[model samples]
Target: MGVLNVTPDSFSDGGRYTDIDAAVQHGMCLFREGAHVIDVGGESTRPGAERVDAPTEIARVVPVIRSLFAEGVPVSVDTSRAAVAEAALEAGAVVINDVSGGLADPRMASVAAAAGCPWILMHWRGHSREMQKLALYSDVVAEVRDELRERADDAIAAGVDPSRIILDPGLGFAKLPEHNWALSAHLGELTGLGFPVLFAASRKTYLGRLLAGPDGTPRPVGGREAATLATSLLAVASGAWGVRVHDVSATADALAVWRATGSPKFLGTRTEDK
Candidate 1:
């Protein structure tokens, strides 16, 4: 999956593709660059980012989605609002990548159900602005797995097809660096829950912190591409269904290597590095 953030305030690549024409072209480029799915998000959900109204988000993404889907590109709407997801589906989106896992809006499940598209349920405790404060977890892996299971159950009960549900651990949403690492290391536990798992670790803050310099300067967004590829490779080796990455071609290349190499586990056991 290639991430296409259409908001001006997103943590990475914001304001770069807000224009409808630019966004469509970028989506096409990503698609040609080996992106299996192009995820278009209108609002910036970066930590501490303010919320954009549903109408504004819809307006920002609908045209882009319509244009891309018209080209036969596989597009996913990265929205938590039912109205926005509805509009995007109407405009031509085949998936709903809801960061809140249908928690943000009570009607999201119904909308997803009605659309009959894949709905990605990410582990989220709250909205972005207050999410960090809610990252507390007794055991990050177990909590996230169990929470994701609950969400899957709720979505199924709400009329969503079980096979159409995907699980995302929400790496940086409400998780600290350690929490993210724990989830990444133990990703099999989440994937073992029988849902296609999506790991989105592209240029996230924790990767920058992990690669911080001696003086404690975090790595810039552009510098995290290597780390992002590393994460993508490991996540694939660890049984992730897919990775949502910013650098699509790099990830596609690395995945090619993994494929050529017979998908050998690049790193040791999940617990070894941890």
Candidate 2:
């Protein structure tokens, strides 16, 4: 999956693609770069980021999604608003990537059910502004897995088919660096849940912090593609269904290398198709 964040504050590459034309062009680039799906998000869910109104978010994503899908690109709506997601569905998005795990809007799960497309429910404790405060956890991996399972149960109860649901561990959403590390190391537990797992650690602050300089300055967003590629490779190797990334080409290249290096079966297949 290629991340096309159309918000002005997504923590990374926010303002870069808010323009519909630019966003469309970027989406095309991602598709050309071998992204199986292009995820378009209008609202910035970065930590501490303020929420945008539904109408504004709908306006921001609908056109870009329409244009890309019209050109035959696979697109997913990255939103937590039912109204916005509804507009995106009508505009031709094929999936809904909700960071809130349907906790933000009561109508979101029903909307996803009605749309009948793949719905990505990420483990989220709260909105970006308050998420970091909720990062506390005992046994981060098990807690995240159980939390994700609960979200999945809720979605299934709301009429979303178990088959169409994908789970994301919400790395860096409300997680500290140690928690993020634990989850990455034990991703198989999440994958072991028997649902498709999506890992989206693309250019996040944690990666930047990991590669911090001697002066304690974190690496800039542009410098994290290598780490992003490494994470994607690790996730796929560990049986993740897919990875959401900003540097689509880099990841595609790494996966291609993995495929050519005799890991073809694991690097190129999804558990969902089984």
Candidate 3:
């Protein structure tokens, strides 16, 4: 998956793709660079970020999705609102990557079920503004797995096909550095939950903290590419179904190398044939 945040305030690559032309161009570039799916998010879900109205998010993503869809690119809308997901799907997105996992909007499950598209349910406790405060966890891995399972159950109960559901551990969403590390190290637990797992630790703050300077300053986002690639490769090795990343070329090259070394099969598949 390629990460394309078409918002002005996403933690990384925000304003870079807000323009419709630029966003479409970048989406095409990412698809050409070997991204199986381009995950376009209109709202900024970065920590401490404020929420945008549904219309704004729909406006930001629909044109780009439509353009990409016209060019035969696989697109997923990264949104929590039912209205936004509906518009994106109408505009031609095949997937819904909801960070809140249906927690943000009561109607999201129905929308996803109606669309019959793949829905990625990430483990989220709250919105970006207050998520950090809800990061408390004992045995983070188990808790996340259980929470994601519950979310999956809720979606399934709401008439979403189980095969259409994917799980993400929500790295850096409501998690602290240590919690992120724990989840990353133990991703298999999540993968073992009978669902495809999406590992999306691309240029997040925890990676910056991991590669911090001697003076205690976190590494900048631009410098965390190496760390991000390492995490992604490890996640693949640990049986992740897919990885959401910013640098598609590097990740594609690395996965090629991994495949050369006898690539292992991923855990699960989406309902639609790939």
Give lDDT tens digits, candidate 2, residues 77-159. 99999999999999999999999999999999999898889999999999988999999997999999999999999999999
Highest TM-score, which number?
1
Instruction: Tell me which of candidates 1 and 2 scores higher on TM-score.
Output: 1
Which residue ranges in model 2 land beyond 4 Å of their true spot? 264-274
Scanning candidate 1 in windows of ten residues, the lowest lDDT window is: 263-272
TM-score order of candidates, top first: 1, 3, 2
Deviation in Å, model 3, residue 33 alpha carbon: 0.4
Candidate 2's error at 241, in angstroms? 0.4
**True-structure lDDT of candidate 3:** 0.94
Task: For residues 1-274, write the lDDT of model 3, one tens digit per residue.
Answer: 9999899998988799999999999999999999999999999999999999989999999999999999999999999999999999999999999999999999999999999999999999999999999999988999999999999999999999999999999999889999999998898899999999999999999999889999989999999999999999889989899999999999999999889755364324333645
lDDT of 1 by residue, 1-274 (tens): 9999999999999999999999999999999999999999999989999999999999999999999999999999999999999999999899999999999999999998987889999999999899999999999999999999999999999999999999999999899999999998899999899999999999999999999999999999989999999888889988999999988998999898888865357556354565
Q: Could you tell me the TM-score of candidate 2? A: 0.95
lDDT score, candidate 1, position 195: 98
- The lDDT of each candidate is 0.94, 0.92, 0.94
